[model samples]
Target: MMRARTRKLIGTVALIIFLGVYAWVAAVIGAGRISLAPAWAQFAYFLAAGLLWVLPAGLLIRWMQRAD
Candidate 1:
């Protein structure tokens, strides 16, 4: 059981890293289209990016809980 827990934790960490980098890249690509966008637009863009990350993270959390 302990081993399973450790594996889940590692998997969750990897998921976070993967999702974070992917989201960042996606955001950067989106940002490139708006060269003159305002500061508020950038802030809103990141907020949207974070919200998108949450859906996958919820799945990761459920998987980690079941790993035990």
Candidate 2:
């Protein structure tokens, strides 16, 4: 069961990283010189999506370490 859970977690983290990269690209292209959105919006978008993967990865890593 632990092995299965770890595999699923890896898949989930990979998906999140993919989505984060896509979102970063979209944000950069959508914001133009005359755009109202702050330049930081791109960074924020990337960060928020990246954290989705990071938080769970951290938790799972911690759990696995403890399990050892």
Indicate which candidate wins on TM-score.
1
Residue 65, candidate 2: how far off, in angstroms? 25
lDDT digits (tens) for residues 27-54 of candidate 1 = 6866696446788887777678667777
Taken over the whole model, the C-alpha lDDT of each candidate is: 0.74, 0.62
Clashes of each: 0, 0
Best by lDDT: 1
TM-score per candidate, in order? 0.56, 0.38
TM-score of 1: 0.56
Compute the lDDT of residue 60 as modeled in candidate 1: 73
